[model samples]
Target: MPKKYLFYISQNYSFAILRPLQAEIQRRGGDVKWYLEPNVNASYLATDEEQLTTVEAVQVFNPFAVFVPGNVVPSFIPGIKVTVFHGFDAGKLDWKGKNTHFRVRGCFDLHCSYGKDMTKQFDALAETYKTFKVVDTGWPALDPLFTTDTALNPYISNKDNRPTVLFCSTFSPRFSCAPHIFDAIKKLSESGKWRWLVQFHPKMGADIVNKYKQLESENLTFIETDNVIPLLKSADVMLCDTSSVLLMFLLQRKPVVTFKGNQQGEHLINVSSPEQIESALIDALKQPDELMQHIDDYIKYIHAYTDGNSSARVLDAVDNFTFDSLKTKPLNLLRQLKLRKKLGYWKLS
Candidate 1:
């Protein structure tokens, strides 16, 4: 008999995208599981949130197989555990260090990204563990954004009747210069050329939050919600920093402008100057067809899945895992424990 598995999904942008797929999986008589945070109320289905420890989580679910996207809590479980990383956020502080994702994965997903730099990171990860399969599934999160009934996304109907530019940036001191990414957008705002949808990350500091709150621009509207893809579509241009939103905008093949900072690390990718920002924004505002062509050539290495059928392909790869297929070695266990200790997630009791 095919194994009845526990599909463990966690909190993040991807869960909203994959929630609808549960019915698709359930029709085949497979059980799916998820963890819901305190804030979200999933009235229709049940999810387990007790994600404090790995062994505890495994014991709680207690299914034939375990499934989870790349989350901090899923690192401790034993047996056939599949991990799917949407991007490189866990180790963004020191991205150059060895990719920790190889330690425990029937699969690790890095397919959400579409930048040239992101492809290089995955290539390095591929060199680390030949055991973990890295698959490019166009972000499963984008799937829902594209498919959800228009009623699910009411922003379009309620949108202000001005052409809008979404300015999205990640929250990090490193990306401090990113707030200025909208300087050009403000120029457009002044001329009543377009409206601006300014979004703040969940991690933004109070100081940064207050700055936006005090802003006197009527042309700008602030957005704080999980589903931002509709806003992405409604915008004429997207001004972004190093956040994954840039990748999503790229999927739209829209023009994205980064900052011209000094140090080019993970969060802050240094561009040339304001001229480049204006140039990129102008290109995005003008030639979307040309930008789509750039996305075709740019996505070759970064995100492998172009079509919206990523979830179907991923399940196919998971189906290939025969019972008792992947063997466990003693050294592998020790390496995992040692790595966890370094990450401070283990007590070794």
Candidate 2:
């Protein structure tokens, strides 16, 4: 019998991240089901691979493991709650006193960690909680970064002689570069010195997205798709601030200029203010080939598996999980309630 697994999808963009693992597990005769959240936009799901909405319905499927791309799985749901994580915990701190990047709220039985730093943190958590298992499986979401397929490009446009610049930002209003760098981008877009590509986190406000869309010109493209690998592939350099997408761009072994950014890495040109973006972009574009040595070190520190087999490693770990030997840990109800309230998901209670 195929080992049934439940993939808890809360956002449409998450589908791209977990699709590789889902396919690999199915190839091994495992059945993967998507448990869509009420707010989820299921337009990303191409086939009817079975989707459930309630915890009771999830129990009916009797999943051997529940893979959550998002945090806080329903407590009543039966299965080994596995936290696959949505993004790289690139040393970003949360408003709360606790480490928001890797805090364990007793919601997961297993944590599939990304790199050495993140893995070390989760491994410590595993030691503290005997029930929790930490696996150093490089992020499967980024597997496509190493692939050669070009059809998956989010933007379809004619190739030009001009160099490409990809501008990306995180969703957090406090840390986003969207509000600060529009003027600089607008000037660049109008100048036509290079082709511009803008892609933002899906959670970015529609108003912000629309504002940027209005500035779109012949040389500029405001991408609205969740897939960013192709954009990363085409770009000669990336510009951002504090977003994990910076790490994604680095995986391409290209130069990146970050504004007031935190995580230190080689070839990462960190600027103190928005006024420096223009110069940074110019420098990065000129020496696109300058940062390979540092980029390689950063990649190794962030992710160990760049061999395009991250999905396979994740599946192997899942297959080896001993369901009977492991006992589920009780949910930290207080913490869960607080987080839900903060995210406006408390009504779900």
Candidate 3:
């Protein structure tokens, strides 16, 4: 009998994160189903995909494992809970000034971590908690970036043969460069010296999104899409502020220019003022050897798995996990209650 798996998701972005894993599972003859939270749009599911609509439906499926891209998963679900994570840690801190990326929520049996730094952190956390295990499986969302052919990339249509720059930003008002750099970008876009592609986080303010949309011209395009791999592939350089998407871009071994980025490194060309945007882009497009080397060293520490087989590694980790040996997870009563109420499931079993 084939093993059964469940994908538990609360946000639309999880679709992109989990689809690669789903493909690997099906390739191995394992059965997979998705359980989307009510807040998530069901229309995002592909026509061939299957969804388990209710708590009862999920119970009936009784999957061998439940994969979650978000922080929490309902413990009542019949499976060994695994966390694949949603994004690369951009070193953002919580309101309390603690790194939230490594926070242990007591909800998962295994954490499929990416890169060497993250694995080391989680390995220490596992030693401290003794309730869960850690596995360095890289990130499945980036598999297509390495596996797909550049000729088939949909975002590379530059008829003018101008150097392309992709601009992206986080939605947080505190960290977003969108509001502050609008005038600089508008001026640059109108100059028609470079082709511009602007994409923002889905939660970005509509007013800010509209302003960029109005700037669209023969040289500028506003992109609205869930998958950013193509945008990363198409752009000669990326400009952003504090968004984890920049990490994804850097993995392409390209240069990135940031505006007041949360983390400063040799891998990035970080600027504090709008007046410096054009200069930074010019430098990034040149791809200086020192900057490119720094990016390569950073990639080794973060994610060295450029083989595009992270999904396969994730499945292998699941297959080899010793679930029975782990210590009992804490009874997080408040969080469990919130999930139960949110899902409207009252059954104790």
What TM-score would each prediction reach against the true structure? 0.69, 0.90, 0.97
Ordered by TM-score, highest first, the candidates read 3, 2, 1
Which runs of model 2 end up more than 4 angstroms from their true locations?
Answer: 96-98, 151-158, 288-290, 323-328, 335-349
Clashing pairs in 1: 70-84
Candidate 2 Cα RMSD (Å): 3.1
Question: Where does candidate 3 stray beyond 4 Å?
Answer: none
lDDT comparing candidate 2 with the true structure = 0.79
Query: For model 1, what is the error of residue 207's alpha carbon versus the real structure, in angstroms, after optimal superposition?
Result: 1.9
Question: Considering summed lDDT, which 10 consecutive residues are worst modelled in model 2?
Answer: 340-349
Give the winner by lDDT: 2 or 3: 3
Query: Best by TM-score, which number?
Result: 3
> What is the per-residue lDDT of model 3 for residues 22-98, given as tens digits with 9 covering 90 to 100?
99999999999999998888888999899999999999999999999999999899998999998999888989999
lDDT of each: 0.53, 0.79, 0.93
Which is superior by lDDT, 1 or 3? 3
TM-score-better candidate, 2 vs 3: 3
TM-score: model 2 vs. ground truth: 0.90
Clashes of each: 1, 0, 0
Residue 239 accuracy (lDDT) in model 2: 90
Backbone clash total, candidate 2: 0
Q: Supply the global lDDT for candidate 3.
A: 0.93
